[model samples]
Target chain A: MIRFDKISWSAGSFALEEVSFAVPAGSYAVLMGRSGSGKTSLLEILCGLRTPSSGSLWIGDNEITSLSPGERGIGYVPQDGALFPTMTVRENIGFAQRIRGEPAAATKATVGSLAERLGIGAVLDRRPQNLSGGERQRVALGRALASRPQVLVLDEPLSALDEELREGLARLLKDIQRDLKLTTLHVTHHRQEAAQLADHVLRLENGAVVRESGPPQNG
Target chain B: MTLRGSRWFWGLLAGITGAYLAFILAMLAATAVYSAPSDLWKALQSREIQHSIWLSLCTCTVTALLSLFIAIPSGYVLSRATFPGKSWVQAALDIPIVLPPMVMGLALLILFQTWFGRLLEKAVALTYTVNGVVLAQLVIGAAFAIRTMHGTFDHLSARPEEVAMTLGCSRARAAWLVTLPAARRGIFAAGTVAWARSMGEFGPILVFAGATRMKTEVLPTTVWLELSVGNLEAAVAVSLLMVVFAMIILVAVRRVGERV
Candidate 1:
């Protein structure tokens, strides 16, 4: 479970005012907003990338408001994937483990499994620069899942793809979330995506959560 | 086939570039040709030349390494962080690059004459010593390194470091694992340029370290000493050696840069 209680932030003229939401464990939450609506900022705040001006954040029962991004136990995939350009896909997926000095065999096993699951096993030896947009996203998703964090936060992971790829990945994400029972907070402006995958939906306007909806039935 | 239109225009520009290259090569060739092999051989075997060559190599290596240590953090801050008087800080970093080498040397000399420098000197002698040579080279070389690394970090997005942090690496680990590795090519380029600049530095060493024989005497100073004593052949030989060595290292570095 991920919870934000009365969280607020101010960056220049933009502000997130008293935003609050909760994603129950094993549920997918979609945050919808127009451009500059503070959806990304909210995601950043939740993942400990930005400090909240007030209030608290919690992942399950643990209060993580004061923790650094690394200590927050949140996996964040940014809007552009932001894969390390110098590292191969295999290395990129295994980065979190490698940095923590996990055993080589374990990292390889984990990375191989994750890549195979993400359907990016063939591009393991290639760098991010050599991968297509969709391939990069899969590799990035694998990287984020490598550490097995408390929650997975994706910022517009499917927005960059073509309609055909987007639909496929959206379903893929749902399957991944359901199979792994991964708590997910996906931020996007696409209403259809929210309808397709979100177990709960929240909309943001002017940096505040303005609406909430229960899980949508199958389309 | 007859060249026409933009082809001639580009050819003209290429001709100008070729002229510049030919001019530099001819000047060096003339010096090398005028110097007798026996004279060049004698200069190479001289104890003073030997000492100067070794000193230049050692001091420049130390200077380059020292510059990298300072540059990494300095460059990251200069590139990534926002602060009051940032423009002023950037300008200060660039001052060494623009200031005359003699002025820099003079500044160092004046600094050592002050109370602070005197206190430091008590800890370890610097003025007119080989250490002074290293210090002088570091000042300018670090400026080059900082500039190179600043641009490098600027060109690279900071998102990877943020991603690393999200993956449970600390701030330092994120830099060590992601950002620094991403900037490896730039680091190599910076180090090579700084080393070359340190090797060729003369005016600062002349003023601050005083070209002392068998002590502070670097390659540039050795050339000066030979010329002063009317050993034209020896001076020319040393100059050729420096040119060749610098050329080889620069070419190797460029190739490595290209690969990256």
Candidate 2:
């Protein structure tokens, strides 16, 4: 579960004012807003990439406001996938484990398994530059799940893909969330995606949550 | 006819420039080969020449390593963070590069001869010593390194380091593992240029370290010394050696830069 209570942050003229939301455990929550609605900012705040001026953030039982991004146990995949171009897909996927001092052999096994599950086993040796848009997204998703965090925060993950690829990945994401029972907070402006994938929806305007819909897809 | 004429004109222009570049290269090659076997060999066997070459290599290697160690962090901070006086710091880093080498040496000598010199001499000697040569080379070489690395760090987005940090690596660790690896080619090129600059340094070594045979003498200083003593053969040999080393380093840097 994830909860934000009265989170406020100011960057120059842009401000996230009194924002709040809650996502239940093992559910997909999509946040929809136009550009400059602080949707990315909210996700960044939850991921601990940006600090809120005031308010509390809770991931499960832990108050994550004081924690660093890594300590928050939240996997954040940015808009562009942000995969290291120099690293092979296998290496990129295993980066979180490598950072945490996991043994090389163990990391290899884990990454191999994740790649197989993501159907990216064949491209494991290739670099991110060589991967197609959908393939990159899958590799990025695999990388995020490598650490097995409490929640996954995806910021416009499907926005960069073409129409055909985005639709396929959207369904794939829903399937992954259901199969893994992973709690996910997906940020996007695409209402159709929200309609299809989200268990619930929160609309943001001027940095504040203005509306909430319950289990849109489940109904 | 018009299209063919334009194409011919462009091709001719390219060919002319290529021929001029090839002519300069041929001259350098001829000078190296002609100086190598007899004059260069005899100079290489001399104790003074051997000592100067050794000193040059040792000082250049140390300067290159030290400059890289310092430049990496400096470049990262300048590239990644915003702080007060950032522009001033950047401008200061470039000062040594633009200063004339002889002026740099003179300034170093004057600073060392003042109260600063006495203070440093108390701790460790500076003026007219091997350390002085190393210090001069370091000052110039580090500037070259920082300039190269600053461009490199600027070219890279900070996203990789940020991602590494989110993956449980500390800031320093992220810099080491991700940022440095991403800029590896740039770093290598910087080190090569720094070492080459140090090896070819003449004015700074002569002014600060005083061209002492078998003591503080480096390759360029040895060439200068041989010329002063009317040993034209030995001077030509040392110059040829320095030119060869510089060419090798430059070629390697170009190859690495292309790959990166």
DockQ for each candidate? 0.71, 0.60
Across B174-211, the per-residue lDDT of candidate 2 in tens digits comes to 78887788899989988987899899888877888888
Evaluated on chain A only, model 1 obtains a TM-score of 0.95
After superposition, the stretches of candidate 1 with alpha carbons farther than 4 Å from their true spots are A99-106, A212-219, B1-5, B8-12
| Deviation in Å, model 1, residue A16 alpha carbon | 3.5
Per-candidate local distance difference test: 0.90, 0.87
TM-scores of chain A across the candidates, in order, are: 0.95, 0.95
* CAPRI quality band, candidate 2: medium
Indicate the residue-level lDDT of A110 in model 1.
99
lDDT of 1 by residue, A16-128 (tens): 88887788888998989889888888888887778898999988889999998988888888989999998999999999898788999999999989988889989999999
Error of model 1, residue A193, in angstroms: 3.4
Estimate the TM-score for candidate 2.
0.88
